[model samples]
Target: MLTILDKYILKRYLATFVTMLAMFVPIGIIVDVSEKINFMIENKVPFLKIAVYYYHFTIYFANNLFPIFLFLSIIWFTSKLANNTEIIAILSSGISFTRFLRPYIIGATLVSIFVLIMGFFVVPVSSEGFNNFRYTYLRTNGQQAMRGDNTDVYRQINDTDFLYVNSYNASSKTAFNFSLEKFDKDKMVSKITASRIQWNPADSTYTMYDYKKRTVGALGDVIVREPEKKTKFGFELEDLTPVIYIAETLTLDKLTAFIDKERARGSSNINIYMVVLYKKFSVPISAFILTIIAVSVSAMKRRGGMGMNLTIGIAIAFGFVFFDKVFGVIAEKTTFSPFIAVWFPNFIFGILAIFLLRNAKR
Candidate 1:
């Protein structure tokens, strides 16, 4: 059921996309290596590890930039067809314009599915390794590799329980000025304070030094003091203090669970997590949208030829990235909804795609 035109268009579409990815990814890696070669040398990082790191980096970078490349590839190939008068010849053979678009839609669908899989499952794992290597080798001293704005952390363990830590050292698994409070309805029931708390990973418990506990009753209050106490708390070390890249490191299911847990804990930066979650799906959907826009914009021969189409495509690509970043920052900084911030660019571009496609058809 496949026509010659369909095969030709589909083959060119996929071939151009892969060729673009192949060409640019090495340039990206070379530039990155040039920038970080000195750091790797100073840190005495092994050559094998550096090579492996760039392997993961390639996946991470390509996945993030696939849409831009996809857009450009479509514009390049379609412009070539237009310049060679293949489009006119096909239409003259009695093919409808809508029929001519079938192969493009099919190619877009394929790319979108691939992107969805990578974004949901593959990119998170690669991103974890990529970020770890960059943080370990590229950063100087006094800069914390973990993600957080403050040392002091406050969290709600549950509706009736709350926790506080004045400062936490993630490497040492230690906290200073730790406190836990429990309330029965609106009345305070018990409070525990410690000068220091340390996590014992072997037993999965925390040891509190110079600890004091106060229990309140209707009649009076009782105080218990100890030099050190070991106990199990409801929260883990990550629950107490999560790194900034935690959201980026989780798969879809884990990310959803994390967001639910953070929301219960009254986390203020839930929007940031929401943005990452939504973007996984939005980025793939944008591929289909951008493909339509690219095909439409470049399918007709122009006075300026392929160069003109590329210039327009690049401008549109940058604009799309700019909108995505601006809206993401607005959502993270202000109270804008992360869902809207993530998908608004797609919505705007979808309209543009329709408008351009209609004009191209006419």
Candidate 2:
């Protein structure tokens, strides 16, 4: 059931959130545009269109960063209420202090759900447009890759059948490098290494350079062979997409898909993808947890008052960020489960929220 208080609080939070967004986004645009003003003028870009670009860019930046403003808004508005004795008045009216939290929880939950949806589905679609705009006109040249010159990556060419490298070239495909490792059941059965690999576009077959092939028979006998001619090998582009995407950029589905893709490809870089996917889910939930923690920390009026709450909130945000960052570094070096690595900070702070909520009640 919706209550009048819920409406009041929601209105207040959204109003303030939007105002802060309105101010901060324009400032960001002004700063960015100032640096590129000469570039725009040199291109003879019309002033009006330039202003429109800034407006769109600002909206995009502001939308991406809205949750942080939402958090701060709730904290600032609630803190103001407590400082002015408004929250105390509400609580002293024989309503349980916990009950006084209903409106806040409702508001937070609604916003959190909306933000999560926007983050997962909506934002990625928007990114295509945003990124395209940036690259097409704004000269984001680093988006493209150079063959043979970029970092080398390995990928499965197809269902346990072959492996490939599109371009080991950090610079050019001429000096390509790739390898194939065969596994039977849980055991490594054979291996092949190549110095330079070439892709055949018409035939969809890969060519190996300075390559050696080895085969392990069922009974453990090993055979090695070398051929002077470029042999047509079965391989496809799907195998290389994961590596290219990873080397290029990572998004939600892209990062998650890379986990399975890498394992299938027999690449050892699974840890990085694991961390990314875990953090995607974990970061949003932490925002919800932080809101709860803030409510608990700032509920009551005391000598420390709102300033105490602000300091504590800032400290807690920092600590949570620190915890997440440190855990991530450890997760990278060690074999820690990705979920635990990413979610532990949220778990720790959720406990802190519960503790503070109890104390605030007393």
Candidate 3:
């Protein structure tokens, strides 16, 4: 399962990764502290909390940069080996480039696995702490647990026919215009429109005042009368939190749920949400593909030294970033599928990796 060359390459790469992390962590902390220093001082934030937030921010940044690290590490290690003619010696010994690639691929696989597991699984668990730490420390604190106001956007929270107001003003929570739409077997059964909605913290039910109602028939007709007022929608208020969570920040499952809810209500424009969902998964995997491409490009040091490879690496990284954003903007604005937008960069680079790897044989 483990070859000597593989172990050597891994050891080299691991040393590079550790060096990068060692240098990066303190730099990361300093940069984060600098960025947030004024906010913390102004907000009277505690030192301990600021320290924790810095760690969280560093983790997020490192996770994002993992692919670049993979690329650079492989490039530097392989380039040094190539400079010393070590790779030539290995090749002269009858080791094909394909055989050499085994170790690199294995190392990349392990890194990719580690990155994915941490990004999707671990970071989310710590997001609450990280975000709260920042929010608490920042000089300007936004309103939390918004109590009330009039005229708010409502989300049909779940399949149970409950709606959540995005932000209700405390001044007049009662007159807020939010409602719950009830459906049965793909037919609109009843609509509760509220002028003012108030959440009962004791029991979690929302009471709407000065509201109205409408019932629709199965055969595309009105089943019953005009809207009514003072309707108390009996559902848990906190169930609406997921709906109110902003589009980009929502996790995969929450976003899927939101999408389903919106679709059921015949929402036509969901391109932005669709783009977010696609980007979430594609962003991490892009690292793997980009890493492969970077290694392939640098491994053949027939011409320039490390400087040339570094320049090439930076260019490729920016190209990936640029195209990724362009596709997202296009997909969000047009009818282009989000899946295409998200995966296009990866596909292009993956092809590049294959081509470069083939050409870079010693």
Candidate 4:
């Protein structure tokens, strides 16, 4: 079932992909370092931390653009094969074009599995580290970036309980103009108001300033007030308002669970989180799709040779990235379906690949 040609192509497939990653990731790191070196120095970031950040950056960078790298590598090597007449000779020996695609499919399957694993497990960890380091060290207002939004926060704690805060301070870990309301079957049962609320981790309680509670009863309404009060609540402040990038920092299981929790809380950013979740699977599928497109485009020898193939490959790759980003932004900002937004690029390119493959076959 094995052949020398299949082995040769598969080897080149893997080697070229790795070579592209190796070549570009360092250049990415260099560019990033040049941009952030002043920030790192200003913040007095430790060298060890810097090294670790770049390590995570390498994984994050490579994983993000892996499909492009893969597409270019295939085009690079296959165009060489075509230009050298190796493919012409092989085709002359009676191997059909479809048969020539077998090794490519095998390579795509292998890379897809690898990409899936990295997206699900490895990339999440590195994304956390990469983002954390950037926010903590490189950003001028790192605390604000790392913390959730500060103004007009609202959350549904559960079916009957809801909360509102006028503003929150990440540095102080305080919420101003905090209000909590409880309802039983659309009738307000109790309301709690505090001018300022602060979490006391030492006692695992909330310290409320100018606190007031109002209870509604059949008999009448009763009100209680205190200048300062300390009590425990069912939720934590951080849980109510997580950082925007929190989804990217979680592994597959944790991300799923977090999304479910956020859905229950009626989060406004659910689309953003769903986009992130869908992309993990979509990126792997893209490996197969881009591989087919790359092979189809480069399999035929042209007058302009590898350079022409590369130019076309780059244009196609940029188009794919452009579609992905535009749809992703639309999904995050509007009511667009995240699933469609994530997969639409692949669908468009998959059709292009089919047309190109048919032409190549002809």
Q: Highest lDDT: which candidate? A: 4
Query: In model 3, how many backbone clashes occur?
Result: 14
Error of 2 at 246 (Å): 3.6
Q: Write the per-residue lDDT of candidate 2 for residues 117-199, one digit (tens) a residue.
A: 66566554454444333332442233222233234456544455556543432212232456777776667677777776665
Task: Name the 10 consecutive residues with the lowest summed lDDT in model 3.
Answer: 143-152
- Show how many residue pairs clash in every candidate, following the order shown: 1, 12, 14, 0
In candidate 1, what are the lDDT values of residues 281-347, reduced to their tens digit?
A: 9998998899889988998999999999999999999899899989998998889999999999999
Scored by lDDT, model 1 comes in at 0.86
The candidate 2 region of ten consecutive residues with least summed lDDT is 140-149
lDDT of each: 0.86, 0.63, 0.64, 0.87
- The ten-residue window of minimal lDDT in model 1 covers 142-151
Candidate 4 wrong stretches, greater than 4 Å: 141-155, 159-232, 236-243
Better of 1 and 2 by lDDT: 1
Model 1 clashes, total count: 1
What is the lDDT, from 0 to 100, of the residue 140 in candidate 3?
Answer: 42
Can you give the TM-score per candidate against the true fold?
0.82, 0.65, 0.71, 0.82
- Judged by lDDT against the true structure, how good is candidate 2? 0.63
